[model samples]
Target: MKRYIKSTIGLCLLSLLFISHKSVNDNTVIKLNSDEFNVLMGHQGSLEGSIKYGPNKGNGFSEKDNDIVYGFTDVNDKITWTVEVPETADYLVAIQYTGKEFQGQTPDCTVEIISNGKVLSTALRGLTQYNESRKVAGTRQWFDEVIPLKKGINTITFHFSEISSKQIKAAKEELDNGIPPKSSASIAVKDIALVRPKVWNAMKVRAKELKPDLSWMRDGKYGLFIHWSLFTYPLYGDKQAFETFEWGVNTFDVDVFADLVAETGASWVTFTTCHGMQMFPAPIKTLEKVLPGRTTERDLIADLAEALNKRDIKLLLYYNMSPRGELAAKLGIEENPDKWFQYLNDFAREVSLRYGKSIAGWGYIDSSFSAYVMNMPWEKYYRSLKAGNPDAVVAISSHWWAQYSPFNDLQTSDSGGSLNNPLDKKLFEEGGRYEGLQEHSSFVLDGSWFPKEPFNGIIRRDSNSKGGPTFSEQEYLDYFHKMAKANVPVTVNMLITQDVTRDQPFVNPKSLEFMKKVKIALGK
Candidate 1:
């Protein structure tokens, strides 16, 4: 099935028809990565694009294979790829992209498939902050939609619109007035994947992750963990909890953090959503109602998930309860534990729904004592978190019930990597208590997950004085690989510092370098 017609309904004012006069007949997968994309810049706006791969090439992933098509500023910009299916069926059309061009706004884009001169499917999607960036579309957005196709060469084009002539005029006026232009809509096309029903690991719920499965984590081996919250803020003589968290929330760059993590070759990340304080980086209505001003409007968690998922790394959030809470006491939270938890559970549901399978795992409430003492419904809470995507692997504090808890999928335990709980089998063994549970052990390399008293978010100290790791490089790798091969997951927590002035967070540079070495030793 072939058609001989050069036409354009217009993705921009002049659709960039990247025509490849070759019919893709293989059933494996048709991928239009950075190398092969032929961009024909239409005569419209300032649309400059080329193949960008590795080192600041813009598609956040650090790997060379994660190349992207940069410079699609015009709404009419369309890139087309030809695919030949086995027969008339549906294919998964996933695009890998970045939305920084939109500057945190939704890029309502168009995607249409033409088969034999007729439109098969055309969808106008109000995509979540996404840039069609991966085989699974990264953020579980509609960019990973299913398109019906006829058995033969089918033309698929991904397009973005906005930045009309009026907006361009406005931007010109702003520039004339010595003001920065704010109305520029652009997107980087990483790659377009046309996959068959074989299903991408992070796709399909995944029959949406429909049932509990830990295979992905077990195989993932080890994860890079970082904790940044109210406690990390430099206090006493520096920025306090709320103040530091707010700054980190606003200034933290997901692209930088994701790139660093990708450079480490770690397959997963366990990011801190809350530690001693519930300074979450997402907008949760329930958290606001429970503790006003506690939640952020930025949706940092979602942004992180999108970025990490783009690099094929899984995300597991650490939602903790403060060991000692004077402020919480004053707020009367202890007086109504059940009601308080109800709000927290709702927030978890919201996070799960927004990120979906992109967030493959979760590290729920830290202390077992608090979970039980507060009468927190573990089963109910578990269900609420999984409601958005049921297949998510959830961990509970290593309680005796964690072994048999119907709602819990993994028994989680944590330590300072130097406490009574050492980083060994005992870390996950729980004194022989976890007889029948998937073991999880997370510990800090800095001896402290968050920066200690005087040397907090606002201050920096010598690495030696910071109470760093007790384990040697070989010791860490030996234990990490041993249990990882046994399907027992490990998360190595590294402390982070907040650059309040710069609105940036710095994970330990030495530790990150070690991770790169670890990735090599592990044969990643």
Candidate 2:
């Protein structure tokens, strides 16, 4: 049976209700109901909504009669309540609310907690109400924070900020364009309680324990990451101008590329499907409908997956979640964040289903840290990927190691620089459910991912001026050995060159030679 903790009324009222009850201590729980609290609406010339009360049956709330307070959509709305404290000390504040979503789309609600007019904490909460019919249920989640209280009556105020009109307009425009409407944010407050620190710690520990296992990632020691796009081509003028899709996609050769990957002796290769300025290669129908003539005619992902499978090399696809530069502006992502996010999810679903088991994993970049990208329903996207291919491992680029572990299969660090020290495996093990480390290392002798000039059809050993400086064989072996010792896998980035006339794409000859020497040094 689940344990339930009740609240304490007051010292004077306690004697009349329960004379035989024990004295309240630091670990005591104090719960406040919505109907009994003071409500302040329209703080700064904002419109006011309504207060709703219902049977608190869902989201772990067992209270009855007027337990929920909701319908405040203005950004300046506030809910204030007073609680009588027995002593001055630290307490854990846990708010229980019901979040509703539509078809797996949800909105964000940010609540700022103020005690005696001083701000204590601000939490951005997600409310998704996708029902059980979708094989995923949107239920209640708890947000807990540590707060200090003084003896006597302490007034705590909760400030609510709803989604802006601009965001809602964007979602409506996307709906008109035949895209499913993302979820909107609404909250039904069941109860607000203050508990001991031990209770809060227990809840955190339970969340960590429920994370998915990622042992397969740890077993794969070294992998190759290819970041090729329009930027791979030579730029004559400003060097910062965006290259056209026609020039970059027309020269890619999957067969020659797969053969070189087989010779590297690496277990896996991650291909950048879409970057900031270009979509490398895709045949998804959704993308074709949304943005015409932007993708490659050849389905490089499918051909590469098939070729790598024969050589026992796994294929991991990389997609940048937060895109910038000219390509993003052309797609009108800046005008409507929700519209672009809907398109992104649709594209992810299409590709994940089309490739299925042939694709071993996915690496999502630039979302975990960006506030705009975090506002979207990324959990639904992750779920969509898993729905298509359950065996595939998913990871996100997050500086906080375990921040995405609850939703993703692994975590990635794009903090790439000179390879010198070993990664702290212990740091990655702390907050996440996964059990591996992923670090990026670049091989351009100049320490850049792309070369300044194009290699003119010849495979030269000393093309440092054309491409970047290639890593020495010893440098590759030493870095691999260091990663292996710490059980951390490294995805080394290598530059690529293309022959437009012959329709050929190949790795830089110097880098390829370095990889072969490293393979021999590893005795593979």
Candidate 3:
């Protein structure tokens, strides 16, 4: 038979169990252990089920020694906790839980916070788990939000939903057939806490105060972003390129590329060191050990950095944070939080130590505004970069998590196209730093970032016998002027060929003329 447990810890008992307390003012704070909630088996049909309760502590939470809650596979599973409020006011509600994805898939669970049957917040999907372990629980990972509570007994219900109906049906069938249900999604909750807004606001303020100044990035209004890889030879686009393992980086000419970048009047040039395919152009000891031959024989990044620095143009290194293909296979372990984080730390440290101060900035992708990446020890990774170059400007994709985290120097305002009308300034305000915005513009006629196929006849201006629409000179100049007036730096994503026959990647005379016109118009 399915067993359910209803447990409660009185206010007096909670006071004794309280391990720590943080106060911004006179407002009272309360932390309730997960096992203390009144758990009913199959309570409500829309939200019906019970969780297995035990003292299996993992991710850092205050009630590590005390029993916690887990074994939530049913979609209708609901956990309710009642808190007595002294006054009716808004309080920051923070839930500390551990979420993990299985079999190389994204985390599959939807959670909603409801108060007295009223929805407090929309369901949040794709919640990520930590890749690190903790010895003693002490509030290491939490999902925080502010909600109003009544002065009397208020019930807060956490509703769980599986990502797909197929998974839910399978679990239900197993339970009916007298077999234990197995779930891909596993979330373990430690506790829930309520704190005054003043305390939360004060914490945000302190985080903002620590943000570094990015004036150097702001001063240079335009940048050139080169996204070349071994996949360039196959002419595969971003998504399809990651499947094959090939290193065609030998055909790249750094000096000629650097000269072309200088001609574009771009103040900085960002190169992709490791992209989706998990191929690194430069040698790193950790990468060599984990996935041998995945790296190129020549250190293209170093040579390019030196070449661009000679022209007084800064270099920003692009690192894809997502684990993919052979790299993931070689690592052989992903679910273990401690082991995964150690791998990430080693990779970051090796890259930072090798580049030193030659690179002016670092841009991380795939974690844009993601809670999963936010939960990782990103502060340690950022520190790794700073240890090598104290003045390095660190930023991430704007579309990813924009909240104030100490890990990044700035947040990109990438709106996906040439137009810069929609600017995201909330990241700067939330993080307590201001580093303008990073916008992307494409130079291709069809606006594709990379070539789709080999010699597809779009690389050169005169080779357009297969005629397609191309951006006019005026259009390019207008974009530059608009971003310049708005004080937002634009990074033009240029497609370079590995054809070896071309003198330079930007061989299209028409596109080259337009770039020169932009330089003249911007008075660079």
Candidate 4:
């Protein structure tokens, strides 16, 4: 029968009993006795234990914790326990075998243990992989070890270093952050079995099995960013005028955009497949009737995807976590959170299934707005994309979870003064250093949001643009070069407008030329 239980104490304790009675061909005997199971301090709930074959197996073993705990593994396995002695002396310890279920190993854990809170001597302090997986119960059976203890009056430090699912995640995250993975925090203590040691072994091993080395991101530093929107049309006035929220009024020229990317010599190019208020390929009959904003008639996404693919440049699609479409309202899922997750999941799945290997990653916009979209169980969505394209990366905007949440493969920043200022620079630098080791596969830089000429109040327009030097090629080069010095990969916007003849508000012949030169200067 399928059983669901929480807590590692149950799993480890139960494994002790089942493994002992299985009568295996190997002569290895796992001894779990009570003399070691009486260290538990509980007030209310009853503790239950169980050990299953694995995530795939259905049948396993079970146990319970009342006043004492029980555990068993290969004879060579070692468990460490830390206790704070009031004074320090020898104390008589014995097992109270009164329960209906009892299974124990030879030579109880009372081998003349002495302690000074400084030194601990155990015949063996860690378990081997063969004994752990074949005899032990849990996810990461390969990485479990006994912990060293430093005793004190108020604190008894117990180590639980083991291979388990949770521990494996910690190791990966720590590796990404460039820190040593420790097992003390991942394990739980039951009665006598210093369950702290080897608790995380299961987690450590699992992480290694799923992910591959991420040394590729450490080198590629520059990529071209193509902001494909309805606003890529020809305009008058300032050549960069189309570089505003007004991109809706513009029509993108796909052929020109593709030619520009190829000419620019960018190793990778990212395009906005969907954005707020507009999409390419003319107004959809459904959106035209329902959505109130301007719509386009061109399938800009399809055009650019094919164009970029032909050039062998890596492609990444940008998706808004918070959609501007009627789909959010139609599902009546706004504010409900859980429903919104389902909607986003479906949308992302469809996007990945269609684009698949052609795309390298999805740029998540407005991801900082909510935790559900930013932090919660979004790994499933990431895995969905990976399933479609095994090598695809998942990039989120602006240090979304760098501080106190799960880290993404990519870090983003908006060069807009608010987030791109010196303060942001300091933050990213520190975060970059911290994450450089663990997430050696990640990148951090500007290009998190729409780079426009101060439209919709999101961007602050320059006060001196009226009298100062008009937007020039040199300024463009300077902009990109500044980003390169920060050790961050830069992705700037190239918006498509409605009119085919007008220059984009922020981009013109001069700026594109400058972008080319800047790429060369950076040797990208």
Best by lDDT: 1
Residue-wise lDDT of candidate 3 within 418-444, one digit each (tens)? 444424343234322233334333234
Candidate 1 structure quality by residue, lDDT tens digits, 27-59: 423322121111111111112233122223321
RMSD of each: 23.8, 16.9, 13.2, 18.4
After superposing candidate 4 on the true structure, give the runs of residues whose Cα lies further than 4 Å from its correct spot: 1-220, 230-251, 277-299, 323-327, 373-375, 398-407, 417-487, 494-496, 500-506
Q: Rank the candidates by TM-score, best first.
A: 3, 2, 1, 4
Query: Model 4 misses residue 458 by how many Å?
Result: 20
Runs with alpha carbons beyond 4 Å of true place in candidate 1: 1-211, 234-237, 322-336, 399-404, 418-432, 454-469, 500-505
Among these predicted structures, which one has the highest TM-score?
3
For model 2, residues 472-522, the per-residue Cα lDDT tens digits are 556667777877776666677776553322344356556667777767766
Compared with the true structure, all predictions reach lDDT values of: 0.52, 0.50, 0.50, 0.37
How far off is model 1, as Cα RMSD? 23.8
Q: Count residue pairs with overlapping backbones in model 4.
A: 66
Please give the lDDT score at residue 201 for candidate 2: 56
What is candidate 4's local distance difference test score? 0.37
Give the TM-scores of the predictions, in the order they appear.
0.53, 0.57, 0.60, 0.46
